[model samples]
Target: MNEFKKTNIENPVVVIGGGASGMIAAWRAASLGVPTLLIEKNKKLGIKILISGGGKCNITHDGNIEDLLKSFQKNEALFLKPSVYKFNNRSILKLLEERGVETYTRDDGKIFPKSNDASDVIAALEWYLRNAGVEIRTDCSVQEIIFENNCVTGVKLNNEIIYSSNVILATGGVSYPQTGTTGDGFRFIEKTGHTIVPLRPALAPIKLSNKFPYGWGGVAIRDAELICLVNNRKTHSERGDFLFTHEGISGPTVLELSKYAAMELANNKVELILDTQPDKDATMLDSEIQQLIGLHPNKQIGNIAGLFLPNRLVNHFLNSINIDPEKECRKLIKEERKQLVKLIKEMFIGTIDTIDITKGEVSAGGISLKEVDPKTMQSRLVKGLYFCGEVLDIAGRIGGYNLQAAYSTGFTAGESAAINYKSQSTTP
Candidate 1:
């Protein structure tokens, strides 16, 4: 067990929220010989962590810093470079490993606990916090951030004010309100003179105007490309596996593009063009279909097409195009064959109605990235104040990128705050 030495500093470094970032920040600060306190509105710490990656807890993405940075937008990648480089996926894995939480990487590079239990990850972090001498308060909500002369003094809770030399607001975003991320940090930081980039649902399921074909729910298309079109012009596209739900579509592909879809839907009509056969062009698919017809002239068109796609989806597409599945391959006219090729190449899935924020994996557009220093995670306008995790405008694509951002930024914030506190306390 590691022992923490008593410090002369009177005020503790207070960390708000008890999720992934807050837990790491508190542990880092306390381990640095600085008194630290972590507060959570929920009854337990790491509530979201427990439910992340469908309860398996995606710890981080496996790759070099440069490759991982590509998962985010250009500006967001630039802002995250310093912290991510300092404390990266390897660093996080090493920390967890030392705490007896071994992790393994998936084929897609997502890292998760070897046991496939999110509870193990939380238990490890909680053990680290306890051993580092970090005090934790649960079921306590912060009403406001108390500041004087633009410097953080403490945080105001419902009952009392807890004084601290440095305060790290890792309160997360408005996503998953049931997990206690209700945009509390945004309100508090906005009150402290910060610009909040309008918050929106990111990495969420897309709700479509046209319902899925009856009994099509739970059907998934693998290795497909989903293209988002605005006014009949393709704006964005993503290639991955997408699953059909009763309302619309979900899965890695849809979730990754949901943010752009939501933005486009607000101002213009947004349609999803699904390319089931992305590997083959119209001419190639048409030629292949013609060859199939010649080989199996007596076979039904639906049976022949079933080789390429699910039987249910093939029937649905045929019905939409006014083609009869019972028609024999030999009976298919050239125009009918052309329609089938077009549908396979690009099937318009209709306009998206909405993207539900409450169901989003991560909330995008929090405190603007420009308002905080990327290196230290300190507020550019407020002294001794830090922002990390989803509370910042940084949200990465699916596959453990968001969790890496949280760990990296949390480490930087805690280390910087501890150094600052030590310097101030030692000064005459």
Candidate 2:
């Protein structure tokens, strides 16, 4: 550890929320010899990190800066470059591996611990902090930000007050309330005279209009294309694993497009079309269907369709085409075949509503990117105040992009906040 020769050691730099971003900011600052105090509302830090990647803890995507930067909100990426590339996925991955948390990359290039456990990731982050001399306070909620003459003096928590020279808010967004993302940080920012963009649910499941969605629950659609259309115009689409739940369809592909779907569904009826075989042309599919009918002329159309889709969808597909389940494959008329072909190509699933923000992987919209210094992450409105993690308007696509943003911005804020704190002290 660098001798925290800042001489402001008595005051310390307080970082709020000890999740992924908060952990990095606190650890980075403390490691550099700046007295750091990390406040966590949860009993322990990295609670969300422990459940990330379905317990495997996807650390980061194996993508270069160009690709990774493209995954984030456009305006926020401009501010993220300085931090993300400064201490990127490779750096974080390497640091954890050094601590014996060996990681392996998935087929999709997402990095996870070799043991595929999220607890290990949390263990490493906690260990890094303890070794770096960072003081951690848990079960403490930040009531408000204390400011004197437009400068951060400290944070108000419960009955007492904690003072600090530099303040970093890494408290995260309103998503995942159980994991401790209370969104109190947004309130705190607003109380301090900052602007917060309207929050929306992103990376969440899209509720379906199938009124009987529970009928298809537990069905899995693989390699299927999910297309969201608003007022007859295709808006967003994704292709991957889609799982049927009691409420709606979810998974990587659906979650990635849910934000766009929610936006469209907000104003009008949105159609979520599922194409079972997007690669096959209409004629090719028609020809294939003809062969199936010819080969199973005596077989029920419901039974024949089961060979292609989920077993639970057999009767549903038949009814959708206005055909009886017991109807023979050969009984399908020419016009009906054409209609079914159209349905096959553009199989529509009505999206009645959207999942709650509470179920989101991350909440989009936070401190507007315009109010922040892209180079150092210091808030322009509040000179010594810095923002990082999901608290900023930088939510990214699924995969490890969110975690990467946290590490990048946290590192940048920790470094810049330390330097700025030292510079201000010397002037007096």
Best by lDDT: 1
Model 1 misplacement above 4 A: 1-10
Model 2, position 405, has a per-residue lDDT of 92
Best by TM-score: 1
TM-score of each: 0.94, 0.90
Worst 10 residues of 2 by lDDT: 1-10
Model 1 lDDT, full chain set: 0.89
lDDT of 2: 0.83
> Residue 36 of candidate 2: its Cα lDDT?
88
